[model samples]
Target: MSPRSASVNEELRRRSRERLLQATVELVGERGYEATTLADVADRAGAARGLVSYYFPGKRQLVQSAVHRLMHLTLAAALDREPRTDDGDERLARAIDAVLGLTRTHTTVMRTHMALILQHEGFIQCPEQQKLAALLEDTIARWGAADPGQDYRLLRALLMGAVVALLLPGAPMPLSSLRAELFQRYGLAWESGCPPNDEPPPRS
Candidate 1:
């Protein structure tokens, strides 16, 4: 093939891949990962199933790509909305707020992430999962000033657990109260005051 033709082909392939990723995101968000099939993704993307396979090899790869893209976009938006400050407590607060805000706005994405975590076979294998873990580790290390290995691991686990609990169905605690509890547990400084909640105050 001529150089010009090869360049055009590469551009086309990139566009197709982007379309596939977008479709995957939409489908996963709407239907959850296990429910979304390659055919559904192809139909949504207006591309052939073969094309998705050509780019991603399998459904797992497609889901991984979509998750990675979603995380990057969401994390960037969260960071932009609440940029990190010099204070460690502020950084932790922002991080907690970011995660909660993301979950509140993008419930489907959070649900998909939870579904992924339950699957032992795919959870650890996906590149997006590794990237998320690394991001969590890096964020904790920066804010906590602790070793990134075990300490960050434990912190990440705690944060994720708190997130899951907040997302649980029919949880008695309100989100605002949950956010405050997280900040306090992590030793974050509250600028204004405790979050608005109907619950009674703790005994002095």
Candidate 2:
């Protein structure tokens, strides 16, 4: 193929992949992973079932792609608004706050992610999960280094468990309050504690 034609073909492939990922996200978010099928995703994306199969061989692959896409979107949002600080503790605190905001802003995505991660053995085995876990472990390591007594792995578990708990049906606490409490419990200052107008401004 000519270089221009090859470029166009690659672009088309990229767009098709993005559409498939988008459909996976929407259907999985609405129906949960177990209830969503490749056929459903193909219908939602207006693509042939064969196209989805061509891109992702199985339901597990589609769900894994969806989860990875969701995580990327969530983390991108959080990182865009992340606070700048040199101190390890301060950076960790800001990260916690950012993650909480992400969870609140993307509740459906978060729920879908958690549901997939916990209930689907395939998801647990996916490479994307390993990448996410490593990122999280690195974040916790930064905080744990600041406080030698803190267990990084344990802290990660607590934060993940806390998100799940807060998302539970009939949970008593409001998201905002729960967020604040979680940060404070980890010895981080709440945004409310900042001086008037001194809170880190939102990112553009």
Candidate 3:
């Protein structure tokens, strides 16, 4: 080949970055945050170690972006799954379930992500995070919010709080309870989205 076009180069770089992010998620989930290192992530991604540094300043930022990507993908899948519709209530319900489900499905990665976010560096503000934010903001707008931006912030805070509650060491709250509270807050029916079980969570 004479030369790789700019578009081809950009696409290659995107794939490389995505591999690193996926590797970070897998390694962190398997080995926990402390045990997982940049080299380890690079090896898992089958890319050079320097590539990780080129894409992220440090391990923490890498992990955060990975988890954000995971969240965005999960939420997108839920929203776009079979039988999809534009019903605001259903979409909001799906969004809540999507984030809450991560605490259970990707426990280790999500826990590590939450911890990183609380540290001095705060959120990474990367493309992955922006994509996730955009998805949630769209969901809120579909839910008939007067101000989707403000509502997205509130929803994000609530989801973070709920994740903390679910992952609180030795004192984790019941997922059903958290789900119930969120559904009630958003005026969603108990049966909407992916309900953990039937019978409306047993009203307290």
Candidate maximizing lDDT: 3
- The lowest-lDDT stretch of 10 consecutive residues in candidate 2 is 192-201
Off by over 4 Å in 1: 1-18, 33-35, 55-61, 82-86, 192-204
Q: Report the lDDT tens digits of candidate 1 across residue range 1-204.
A: 999999999999878887888898888778877799999999999999898878777776677677666765655455445344545555556656666665666677666665566664545454555766676666667676657778666766765676677677677346666666666677765552223344453322
Root-mean-square deviation of Cα positions for candidate 1 versus the true structure, in angstroms: 4.3
Residue-level lDDT tens digits of model 3 in 1-204: 335687788899999999999998898889999999999999999999999999899888888999999999999999999898999999999999999999989999999998888875778899999999999999999999999999999999999999999999999998999999999999899889999964358485
Question: How would you encode candidate 2's per-residue C-alpha lDDT over 1-204 as one tens digit per residue?
Answer: 999999999999888888888898788667777788888988898889899989777876677776666564554444345354445455556555555554555667667666766876635445455655555555656655554335655666666776786677676345555555556666666553221242333322
- Candidate 3: residue 115 Cα off by (Å): 0.8
Clashes of each: 0, 0, 0
- TM-score for all models, in order of appearance: 0.71, 0.64, 0.96
Query: Candidate 2: deviation at residue 26, Å?
Result: 2.0
Q: Please report, in order, the local distance difference test score of every candidate based on alpha carbons.
A: 0.67, 0.63, 0.93
Query: How far is 10's C-alpha from truth in model 2 (Å)?
Result: 7.6
Quality of model 1 by C-alpha lDDT:
0.67
Candidate 3 — number of clashing residue pairs? 0
Total clashes for model 1: 0
TM-score, candidate number 1: 0.71
Candidate 2 TM-score over all chains jointly: 0.64
Residue 54 lDDT in candidate 3: 96
